[model samples]
Each structure stands twice: as C-alpha cells, then as structure tokens.
Target: MNKSKIVVIGGGTGIPVLLDALRKENIDLTAVVTVADDGGSSGKIRNAVNIAPPGDLRNVLIAMSDMPQFYADILQYRFDETDGPLAGHPLGNLLIAAVSEKQGSISTAIRTLGRFFHISGNIYPSSDQALTLHAVFEDGTEVAGESSIGKHEGLISHVYLTDTDTGGAPIASQNVVNCIMDADMVVMGPGSLYTSILPNVVIPDINKALLETKAKVVYVCNIMTQRGETENFTDADHVRVLHEHLGKKVIDHVLVNIEQVPQDYMDNNAFDEYLVQVKHDFAGLKEQEVKVISNNFLRLVKGGAFHDGEAVAREIMGLSKRQAD
Candidate 1:
C-alpha cells in the first residue's frame, strides 16, 4: 500500500490556512511556497540579505508545525516602532535570515527550522534565490517589483519571474520539480492569484512539471476578488488565466465557493484587497473542460472572509482517496 503524496503550491495567508489543516491529516504533504514577495518585512529583509524572502515561509512553517501557541507567539512577535531599525520585522524572519547566512542558502535554512519547529510536512520555496515579479499590464506597460505590481492599478496581462539580485531567469528550487512530478495530487491557490499563486507556476521548470505530472491538479479558488489583481474576476476568469499560462486546461478540478459573504461583512479598512465577491460562471467553467467542486466553503472572522481550512482539506483528502481507490 502506497501512501498518497500531496503537493500544494502557493503562498500568502491562504496557503498557510490550508497547510495548517493538512498538517493534521495522514499523508505525505509538502508546500511549494512562492519566493516572489517583495513587500513589508520581506522586502526589507530581501534588500538587506541575499536569502529568499522568509515572510511567507515563516507563516507557513508556523501553521504547519506542532509548536505550541506560546512558542508560535514568540516566533510571530513583531518589533514595535520603538525599536529602531528592527521595527516591523517578525522574530522568525530574523532567525531565518541568520541561519541562511550561516548555511549559505534559504533552502537549508527552511530544512533546519522545519526540524526545530517539529513540522510533519515538508516546505520548499519555489525558487532557491530571491525572485522579482514583473507584471505586464494591458496597456503594454511594465512594473518591476512585486510590491509595486500590487500598487499599480491596471489589468495585468501576465507576470514573469527573474532573479532578484542578478536579473536572470528564475528556476524552480531543488526538489520542487521532482516533488510535483512524483506526487499523487497537486493543489494550487485560494490565495492572491497574481502575486502568490502565479509566482510559483510561472517558473519554467515548475510549469513543465505541472504539464507533465500524472498528479491530479486541483485549484482552490479564492472566495473574494482582490483589488489590483483579480478584481471583478469570475471563478471562470481565474481558471482561464491559469490555463492561458500553462498553454492548456491543465487544472483538473477547481473548488469554488458557492457561499455568499454576509452583506457589508468585510472590513475593507484592514484588508483593502477584499474588494468584492468573485462572480461565478459554471458555463464558462464547463468550457474549460475541468471538474468544478462547488460548495459553501466560507469562513469569516472579525469581518474578514476566508476558506474553512479543514473543510477544504477534507475535500482534497476525499479526492485523493478516490484517486487511490
């Protein structure tokens, strides 16, 4: 009997939520996190150090680890404004930077920290080196950084990756391609479509694996449309963009949230990206020739809308079972 291997690809808060739930399940779970982040503490760290951005990985590691709340709190602690030069950085990010400097690679740093965190699932960055995301808007204009891309208000035609320091083409991190090809299933998204999810698949080697892998590729669609990214996009539009990138309808299943967010429930002040609920087009989805797993997967907290991690994980687990059986 062979255990099912599931590889999830993406970053940001959404992927971590799914991972947090998947960590408790019995299977071979691994995360392929995006390294195209260049904002906030991650940007500060990337500019100062040569390591891959640690912010996403920090959130990911904490979510998937067996660490107690107390230790997780310690790692998540942020320096207040009173702390000169250290303000806005998490303790975990600093720790990752320190270890990466000693080991000469962020991949090594992730492995070392994974053991300390007592993580059951493996975590791998999409690329070994830091990545810069460049977006081409509908007007043929180009924006150079991931931080800036989110701020630029235009329909993004496409996004591509490059090495942060040397401006060379980006490659998949070691073992990332192998993990994808050998997996029983691959999950993508429920995160920022352009910045978090696309950053990983847009890498050449990763794209090839997705195209060639026998694994059932599933896309967990985001509940809310994000401004400056998937604003005004339907569930089908999201699928179309992904298919356009991969050159075919590579996604086998797409999980859509049929549940509606309560009226005026979103706190746009804190999360400006929560622009509107994503519209659905089942006919459009059918045109893509992929299975749609529609359900009431909404989970709200303090006026913020999110996916029910355990619910989504259960659905994925069921799919894996069906595949294995």
Candidate 2:
C-alpha cells in the first residue's frame, strides 16, 4: 500500500491550483518550481537580495501546506502602495528572501519554510542560483528576462537560460534531477508553456533526466491561449513544442480540456492577457503518438477559465494506476 511518488514541475498560478488538488490525494508529492520569475514582488526581492524568486515556491508551499486558513492568509497578504517601499510585496516573498539570505541558499530557505508551514509535500527550487530566461524572437532579435519575453511582438524562436558560465547555461541542482529520476509520475504544466514550465525542463541535466526517467510523464495543456506566450497554440502544438525542447518522446499522456468555453464568459478587457481558448488538436496529438485524455476539465470563476484541479487530479491518479498495472 505504498503511495505513488509524483513530481509536479512548473511555476505560476496554474501549478498551485493543480497542487492544491493533488495534495488531497494519497501520494508522495514533490513540487519543483521555476525560479526564472523576475517580476513583481519576486523580482524586486531577487534583485535586492540576489536570491532565486520565491513567489512560485510560496504559492506551491501554501497549496500543499496543512496550515490553518489564517496562516495561509497571513503568508499571502500583500501591502498597498501606501506602505512605501514594501508596497505590493507579499509577506511570504519577503520572508523567503530573508530566510534565503540567512541560510545562504534558496533550497535551504524553502525547506525551512516548508517545515514552518507543515507542508504535506516536498518543494524544491529548480536551481539554487537566480536564473534568467533569455528568448530569441523569430526575427533573430533577442530578449532577456522572463518578464520581458512576453512583451516582444514576434513569435519566439527558442528560449535558453543565461547568467551562468557553468557550460555557459543555467543548471538545475543535483537534488532536483534525482527527484525526477525517482518519481513514479512526472506532471508538467497547466502553466505558461515558455515561462513557467519550459524554464525548468530546459536545464540540460533536467532534460536529460526526463529522457531517462521510467516515470509516466503527463502534460496538462492550458485551457486558454496566452497573449504573448502562446497566442494561437493548439493542444498538439503545445505538446510539439515540449517534445522539440526536451528532444525526446518523454511525454506519455496529455490531459486536455474538451469543454467549450462560453463565448461571452471571457471578458477580454479584464483578462486581456489571455487571448483565446486553446483549440483542440486530436489529430495532431495522434500524430505525435501521445495518448490524449480529453474531458470537461474547465472551471469558470469570475469571468476567467481555469482547470478543474480535482478533475485533473483524478485523471492523473488513473494514469498512475494504469502505469502501475
């Protein structure tokens, strides 16, 4: 009656939603979060303290924590502009930064915070050092920084990590690689393909481990297209990009949403960052030899579309069982 080992990789809001659901299941969960974020409270803190961005890690920690509602609220509390220099910064980000500085590494700080919050799952930053996400546009122009990649108007040619001379590329810690290699199942995305998910996998060691792992790798496709990142990307197109980057047939299953989004439910002006619903591409998926699990995995909240975490988790559990069988 051993629990299955599941390693979820990615960053941003989508990942936390998935983790929130996964935490309720009987599994050994480990969240390997991206550290390429250089915007908002995370960016400010990282620049000032020279540490990995902790915003994604904080969200993932809270999602898997067994703490009371009040504690979660306190960690996520944000200050207003009236608060001066600390304006718009979440309390958790500052705390993580302080702990990272004190402990001499983000990995240690994350573990300390996890213990403090009584997290149900393990959390690891993709890298110990701060990594910058650099992208080359289709026109050969290049943009540096995860926050700035979306601002470019051209299609992204490819993205790679900079700011390190270690083989001239950013690298993942050995601990992160070992977790992936040992997992029974590895889940990727439900987040921004380029910024959130790919930033973690593109690390040479991680990419190599993904190819070597015996785990059932599952990719949860986004329900909608992101304006700057994946403007018109289809479900299959998403998988294709991943395959191209990882340079192998690592993905075993792709969980996609087939439920149609209501035309008017999405307020473009309010959610201007999101462009359109991600088009279904079963044919393309078939061509890629990826087993497609399509279902009504949509949950609408406040005029925006999101993955139904419980539904997605159920599918993941089924996949794990099937793999075991």
Candidate 3:
C-alpha cells in the first residue's frame, strides 16, 4: 500500500492554514502555491530580485517545516520600519531570494529549503518567473498587478497572467504539472479566488494537466466574501467562475461553511478584506452536479472568519483514505 498523494493548490494566508493542518495526516502532501503575488513584502522582493514572489512560499515552508519555533521566528522576523536597509522585509524572504539566485529558480530554492528545513512535504511555486496578474472587470475595465486588482473598484470579469520579465506566456514551474497529474487528489482554495488560486490553474500547462488528470478536484470555498474580488457572490458562484475559466465543470467537490458568524465579532479595521458571509446555493451547486460537503467549518477569532483547518483536513484525508481503500 502507498500513502495517498494529495496536492493542495492556492496561496495567500489561507493555503498555509490548511497546509499546517494537513501535514498531520498520514498521507503525502504537496503544496502548489501561486506565483502571482505583487503585494507588500512580496512585491518589493519580486521587483528587486526579478523572481517569483517569496512571501507565499515563505509561509508555506514555515507551515510544512518541523523546525524549532525559535528558528521559525527568526526566519519570520521583520526589522522595524524605522530601521534602514532591512525594514519591512522578513528574514525568510531574504533567505529565499539569496537561495533563488544561488540555485537559479524559485522551485529549486523551495526544494532546497524543504529538504534542509525538514519540511513535511513538497512546496512548489506555480511558475518559475515572477507573474503579474491582470484583471478585466465587468465594466469594461482592465487592471494589471495582483495588488492593484484588489484595490481597484470594479466587478472583475476574468483574470490572466504574463511573465514579469519578458511578458511571455506563463509556464508551469518544474514538478508542478507532474505533481498534479500524479496526485490521488487535488485541492483548491480557501484563498483568494482571483489573485491566488485562479492564478495557478489559469496557467496554460497547469490547466491542461488538471483537465487530463484523473484525481478528484476539491474546492474549499471561503467563509467570507472579499470586497474587491467576490462581493455579493453565492457559494455556487465561486464554482461557476472557476468552471467558466476552465472551459468545463472540472471541480468534483466543494467544501462550504454552513455555520453563521455571531454578530459583532468582525472588526472591520483589522480584517478589511473580508466582507459579508457567503450565501448558500444548494440548488445551484446541485445543478452543476458537484458534491457539496457543507459543515460548520467556520473559525471565528479576533473579529474575523476562517476555516477550521483541522476539520477540513479531516474531510480531505477521509476522502483520500476511502479512495485508497
């Protein structure tokens, strides 16, 4: 018997949460993170080093690693904004950038770190080059850059990517296609639909592999709608958008949160990106013929909503175990 190989896809803070929990499962875990980040610390390094942004990669590595907490803290440490030459940059990002230059690609840098840091499983960037996300809004408007897409006020119609250095079509990072193709299951989301998860699947080779792979594709829907990306969207709408982009219904299962958030818990000042809770659409989901695993997957803390990663991980691994059996 072999360990079930599962590939978790997406980026941002959400993927790391799931990765942390999924690492505990008795299965083979691999994180296929998006490279289309151009925001804050990631943006700075992507510009300076002309490589895939390392912010998401850094978080994923930390989540997968069993290193001492003190070592993790040192890698995650940030210099004070008042300090010169090192302000706002995480030590992990610098380490990745240095290793990327030495190793010649972000994929190799991640591989090197994963082995040396004792990561539980694999972490691969979705692409080798730094990618810029471009969005076309419903109002006949276009925006470039991942950070700008969220800040720009308009209903996004679709999003795409281009190479940061040469403006060429984006290609799958080394091992990403093979991982997806070989997986027993592929997981998507709990991250930004447009700027994070979609960026990876929208890549030409990645998309092709997804279409050809026999693995079960599960979408972990967000608990809350994002202001700029998914405002006023129903749970089924999320799947619809993904289906539209992928040219057919590819996602096999969706994990939706059914529990309602208690009133007065959300602090808008701290977590401004999240808006109202996502509405349910069981009929719509049924119409798409996708399995809906609705549950009380919400974890409300410090005035914001998040998925209970352990709970979701349990569901995911349960499915994997059944398939293996």
Candidate 4:
C-alpha cells in the first residue's frame, strides 16, 4: 500500500500520543508543533538562551521514534533527588537544548534527532520565532504565556501571536509548508486551544500555507474543557473558535467524541487536576456546517477522560481512506 502523507498540527502531550497511533498505520506523518510553551524546563532553557521552545518538538519526536523503548526513555528522563541546578529538568529537554546550540537552529537539531532515533515520521516547529501567546478575555483583559492564562479563570475571547513579523526557523516553516502542500489530509488539535492550536495558526506563513493547501482539514476536538481558556466551550464552540481564527471555509470536517465519560474517573481527579467536563454538542457543531464524526474517543487516564490517541488515529485513517474512495 502506498503511504498517504499526513500533516498533524498540535503540541505537548497530544501530538506525541497522536503520532504514536499514526506511526503504527505506516502513514507518512509530518508533525507541525507549536512553540509557545512558557513553562517547565522548556521555559527555563528558552528564556536563558534566547531559543525557541523545544518541549513540544521533543514530545513529537518521541511519538514518532522507532526505538521508543530505548531512546524514548532516555530522552524523557528527568533529574531529581538533589537540589542542583538541573534537578527538575528532563534529559530530553536538555539534549534538545544542546542540539540547538550545536546545530545553530532547532530544525537542524530535530532533523539530527530524527535520524538518530529513526523516527517513523518527520516533525517540525510551527514557527522559528520564540513567540509568546496572548489571550484576550471577554472583559478586554489580556494574558500572556501558557502558564499564566491556564489559571486566569476568564473567557478567552481571542488569541494571536505577539509578533507575526518575527522570522521563523526557516527549515521548520519550509517543512510545514511542504507537508501541507503535499499531504492528502491535515489534522489539527486534540491539544490546548490557546497555547497549542492557536499559536500555530497565528504564524503568518504557516496560516498562509494552510489556506493554500488543498488537503482535507480535520479538527480532532478536545475531550474536556479547559478552565481559563475554554471554560464553557462545547464541541461547536471549539469549531467556531478555530473558524474565527482561521476562517470558516478552511475546515472540512470535525471529529467529536460522543461517548459519555465514566463518573468515577471524573470524581477522582476533578479537584486536583483542575479538569473541566466537556459534553457533546452535536447540534451546535452541525449548525456550523461541519460534518461531525462521532466516536468513542475517551481513555481512562489516572481517573479522567483524556483523548484516546490510538482510537483517534484509527478514525483518522478510516476517514481519510473513506474520503479517498
């Protein structure tokens, strides 16, 4: 079977999980990861060295890794036990930082890792800029950075890049454009709305490339609501936000999970995890002219309804093939 090229756009935990599923399908995957993370070891490294965020890219690479049982563990290993400077940092984050220094750019470093780990698919940053995310609240308040906005407890009215004119890592942007142009389908989201998904769309060249691409655009909606960013967002609310950001005509389909989440799972983590319950709103999505593919997409993760990456990937493959037919 000829491998169909796919461009998956997202960041953080979601991308890695999605890639893991897609890689097993033997598809030619190209991940366009957001670079707006401003917390954890990624933030520490980027701020100190004036470099773009590497955490998302690192996660993507692990998702596509051929030897995940080996290199994946090494890459994700975190230091602890001592109060040293590197105590809280993940080994993967540090390695990526070193690679960035040695190779002179994040893209170059990722390409090297891709080769070293024999990653099943290619991964690229959405932009080269060390960009920051700013969210405008319904009350006209603005919050900058992922960490700050997560705790804002306000409705995110709009989101945009702080500086769209700032140059991106040329290699990453080129790869993203090329993937979009060549792909049979482009997958967006199943990640954070403001920081992960919007950050990528706000990149000037990336958005232009997406608009120009002829590929079928599929938005894999998130399973649960986010507190400050997407407080009351239904499935339709998710689609509307993207349409408002990227325009209505850009998206072709929306994949939503219709299966109900287990009550006990939510009960355990509701308070500690700051998790928000997301209910299916089929009528709302249908109103926007988006054909919704409803499925069971929730996985029990530490007592919560998080996206089941493998299930999502299987649906994506099935839908793409059905479209092709």
Q: Which stretches of candidate 2 lie over 4 Å from their true place?
A: 164-167
lDDT of each: 0.92, 0.91, 0.91, 0.80
Instruction: Record all residue pairs in model 4 with backbone atoms less than 3 Å apart, i.e. clashing.
Output: 128-168, 128-169
Candidate 3 lDDT over 211-256, as tens digits, reads 9999999999988999899999999999999988887898999999
TM-score of 2: 0.97
Rank by lDDT (best first): 1, 3, 2, 4
Model 3: worst 10 consecutive residues (lDDT sum): 316-325
Candidate 3 stretches with Cα past 4 Å from truth are: none
lDDT of 3 at 316: 92
TM-score of 3: 0.98
lDDT of 3: 0.91
Tens-digit lDDT track of model 1 for 1-325: 7779999999989998899999898899999999988998989998898789999999999998999999999999999978999999999999999999999999999999999989978999999899999999999999988889878888999999999888999988769999999999999977999999999999999999999999999999999998888889999999999998887789999999999898988988988877899999999999998899999899999889999999999999999999998
Query: lDDT by residue for model 4 over 135-245, one digit each (tens)?
Result: 888999988787788878668888877542353333237778788888999999788877788888867667777788889899988887776777778888888888888
TM-score, prediction 4: 0.93
RMSD of each: 0.8, 1.3, 1.0, 2.5
lDDT value, candidate 1, whole model: 0.92
TM-score for each prediction? 0.99, 0.97, 0.98, 0.93
Error of 4 at 107 (Å): 0.4
